[model samples]
Target: MNSPSLVATASITSPHRVGCQAGVQIGQACWELYCLEHGIYPDGVPYNDYGDGNLDPFFSETKEGRYVPRTLFVDLEPSVVDEVRHGVYRDLFRPDDLVTHTEDAANNFARGRYSVGQEVVRKVLNRIRKQAEACSGLQGFMFFHSFGGGTGSGFMSLLLEKVMEEFTSPSMLRFAVFPSPRMSTAVVEPYNAVLHASTTMEYDHCVFVFDNEATYNLCINKLHRAIAAIRVKKTVQFVEWCPTGFKLGINSGPPTVVPGGDLAKTNRAVCMLANTTAFREAWARVNLKFDLMYSKRAFVHWYAGEGLEEAELSEARENMAQLERDYEEVDGHDDDLMDNHEF
Candidate 1:
């Protein structure tokens, strides 16, 4: 028989590549699966979300295509919910009126009504529960909420916690697309509280966190208009790869933070799916912390000692420096510093 600790630690790893299907509720649904699959039952006791506590994601993909959305969680704002009730959610569901209940709930949540918030939360959870039940069982979920205004942050974390109560599969993964830091403050305050509560919540699972700040940093450092353009369904794969790749490394043994050029190259190799010459050239120049060498281009070039244009390499190194600065800033965090967990 398995020891108690082993049993507790037992968790699921995705056998195949994971993807986010964003036409609907992406955040809520994606996170559930990411946590469940990635969760590690170290010594048998299941760890909570946020790796330091419990459960580590397993499985790594060498190719960018490996990260795809299987489940999705649509983020409903009070206004959007109102629209849904009067419009979409109803038509999408069935039986009667088409009005957005989520928008109404958003108003209630922001007003900070304990009772109204609970009801709104409950209704949203119920919808998720019903959907999960319909699936018979789920693998992972995609979180599609904007990290802009207050409503998204106020309830996103709470929503995940509630979903975990009913959808207790193996590992629950949470993937989210947060807004840029400049845009997040209005929402981050509330998001901070939610994140704090979520970290402590027992039912909470691993979150595939996305930060608007992080995205912004990438865009600014890389001299790109928007991070999304390069991603175009490519960002999720990179994000998924980062954690899962790290997790897999740990499972195989343990991991140490990779550094210098290795880290940047690894991140670039995984982050960019388009094999454009520019992208390939870019990856060659940057260094990363965890050099799993999980990318084909990385390995091929690594072995061959490929060359990059001097100008391209120079710009890429600047981006790498920015990343290094940002990573260091957030790595040494405490509860007091929680407000700064950018990505």
Candidate 2:
């Protein structure tokens, strides 16, 4: 048989309780959906004698014939990890794969990137390396993280840098939860978000940005599910160079709602995979906010004390400004270039 194309997923959460809870909820929902789709039980055993779909991408079979998900849950704090350890799907993960640290990043990017995060990064990397070594044909990595929190933004950025250095061939895709000021959790969110984006721009192959405000608005309006994809695509703009930026799929079956979750039952679901330039607008907004706070040197000492230099902040701002321009450039067609010309 040909080598299985394996893809690993890593869910990195911030130290904050809210961020950790959200990460775990999403991870649980994903595990539940995968189990249902592959006809696997919560304990990782086959549901029936009929083996139907391919599970190689997301699962690895053990010597005892149990299939465990190829996923990792990471955080700088252990409370959320402990919860998952005792949760309903506890049997679905290996103990070593769920990595955590005793101390937290304390909502500071510099602390996560340079100080406390460094203490646990090696352990996290070793776990990732172990996962990669098991695959015969490893395809890529999928990261789920929040953009506005310390561990999610700063520690994740540090991890991305290390991953790029260690595994150069595998593509990296991110599912980033963008921050909304209306539902902001911390005063330094803008700083974390901007710095995270600027640092990881080159590391990520593609990113799917999720907005809590948009989701909250959708729920409040009780909008039709069928038109949601269309509305979202209409609002976002993609680059002209990439024609297949948006891919939409309709699943006949309804989404698998998590137990005790607030999501309503629905008949159908629309999933949209996108690579758009619209995220540059979010970067722009955060950068503007960062500048407003940074002009007065507010909260600079916290990061500086944690080993972050003032020059790096200036460089990050410049990097984001250039990134915005790069997006704008890609969105427009180049009239000077002839399609028929050959290199």
Candidate 3:
């Protein structure tokens, strides 16, 4: 039997674009407002507390009720540290919370100009592992990363890898808003990051992808665009879909082609259960369905072949069972009751 190469796994690592953080916050805030109006508590708080003027910022809980907005600085440029650390971006993060790629590390990668951004990513993964463990007891970590630009795409993938490596015991779920090639970035980095991330699906799962192009088409003017993009009328449901042992990362293109026909338009929602019997049941209950039809590859036609070895596929299936069981047990806990009812 042939081994399950990265190509085969890559097919399953499909990603959806969820527009920018502003859009996500708008969506969440709308949901929170709706819930508040109906006399129910909001689930996850939107990252932007001040307003939509700033890009989406990362927020962490202090184990106490306080929210600590942290800015993690990771990039191939040392100047980015200065930009984020002391410049206009300084207002975003807490003091002493910024993390960056070493000057030597970033310089080497920049000089070589590798497409992967592996070295800088390695540093980011290590730092995040430590930070995530320390903050694990808190209300989980939230990242407001953009799918556009080089640093956000590169660093987001790397940080995700490290979190998976360190946290095996029911790790905190990740929520990402992928940028549309037409809107988030006209550059090539997002296209590259999408392909790379897709190829490495064994590393992460349940990404909320969105496209800027779609949003742009929907909005008529800047004011309408701002309002429409940031204000989706729905409750921000924080669904924690654990990795379930089988990791799924997304990699696609700087110019990936969207699949043709209805498939081309549909936003594929994938629910991965760690190849186990228990997880199968959980997956059945979860019923993750793709509500929107968005193209997986937006423009670039980079195609990675698919096929997994029988043994690897079997193991993934087995893991799914345990994950399903774990999901029911943990997810079953009533967050609504706990939030409203005091001890």
Candidate 4:
């Protein structure tokens, strides 16, 4: 129940990571994250050993590995396909995963009759629905897209309405983008944003929204000033928040040195490089708000009765003991260290 089974769809990203095609870069990030998750946890990996009732993946590894998630992409843009097929996305996803529409939906979502987007959306979901029926392991579905664009917003609207009508077993979640003023491409973006948002009120169980400007503007002064970053509970994990700033030091001169090594030159050079207006790293402070989740009672009745069949009460007890052992291991394992301390 702690590590929820994740099946990521797609979302936008900072242009620093993926120049203009931040949307597609999100797919690449998902693949990399899926592959590298084990490395993140020395023992910190999320449990994802579900969803494998012969629901054959889009691709398989060289030596018959059992570790692959079912991936499917529904899109209308041929260029998106070209870039993905030839770029980083191809390195992660195979050609079998693509679920492309013949014609592009050009800002006409309000008029769904004009495009094949809805038809394709229904077809893909229907194909997967049959597969899902064979296995009770379809934990959830994650819908991701930018609200401003026609295809993402329009096709997504169709998905939200139809997915509920089609399947009732898996829970629904959304990773939606609240388009910022600068990045929105369509003139009718206001209508799309409101329409998508209002629609989510009915269909989606939970929606996580990320703003464009908030992601791009990375100033330590605003996000995490140096003193605020490393004061008390602040530690090495908080180093990203401790960035000073950045400056236009690309073509700037080599810094002048003080006669007696005053360190003023080095300091000036650093300040010039990080001149308070540059991008600072975003802090991973999402945990701060998670306390609110515990403030209210959860509808966890279904979760209690559902899970792996082999699990037992003894396994639960051993897991608790393992947590106590992990806390001890964090201190590098001493037999009687803090033995006299009060629990």
Between candidates 3 and 4, the one scoring higher on lDDT is 4
Query: What lDDT tens digits, residue by residue, belong to model 2 across residues 1-343?
Result: 2344333333434323355544554666678887877778889998877376678888899999899988888878888878778988889899998888887777778888999899989998898888888887788887777787778788889999998999866777677778776777778888888788878878878887778776676567635444457545453344457544546566666677655667777777666554555456667678888999999999999999988998988888888889988866865523233122121
Q: What is the C-alpha RMSD of each candidate to the true structure, in Å?
A: 21.0, 6.4, 18.0, 18.9
Against the reference, the lDDT scores of all candidates come to: 0.32, 0.74, 0.35, 0.45
Over the stretch 1-343, how does candidate 3's per-residue lDDT look in tens digits? 1111000000001123322223223223332333232222232233333333221123344444333343244444444344435643244344444444443221111111234355555555555554554442433334444443334444455455555666563323333444443332233333433333442357554444443443454353332332233235322222447423236665341222222313333334444332322223313321221101112332222111111122332243335445555655654544354344211
True-vs-predicted CA distance for residue 304, candidate 2, Å = 0.9
Q: Which stretches of candidate 2 lie over 4 Å from their true place?
A: 1-22, 217-254, 257-259, 330-343
Model 4: per-residue lDDT, tens digit, 38-140? 2221122323653333223222223434333445555665556566567633544535455566665554334322254655776667645654553335566
Top candidate on TM-score is: 2
Worst 10-residue stretch by lDDT in candidate 3?
Answer: 4-13
Clashes of each: 75, 0, 55, 6
TM per prediction: 0.37, 0.83, 0.38, 0.52
Over the full model, what C-alpha lDDT does candidate 2 score relative to the true structure? 0.74
Full ranking by TM-score: 2, 4, 3, 1
Point out where model 4 deviates above 4 Å: 1-23, 39-63, 88-94, 111-114, 130-136, 217-221, 224-343
Model 1, 34-85: lDDT tens per residue? 4344442212223444354322122221243132222222333333323333
* Candidate 3 lDDT score relative to the true structure: 0.35
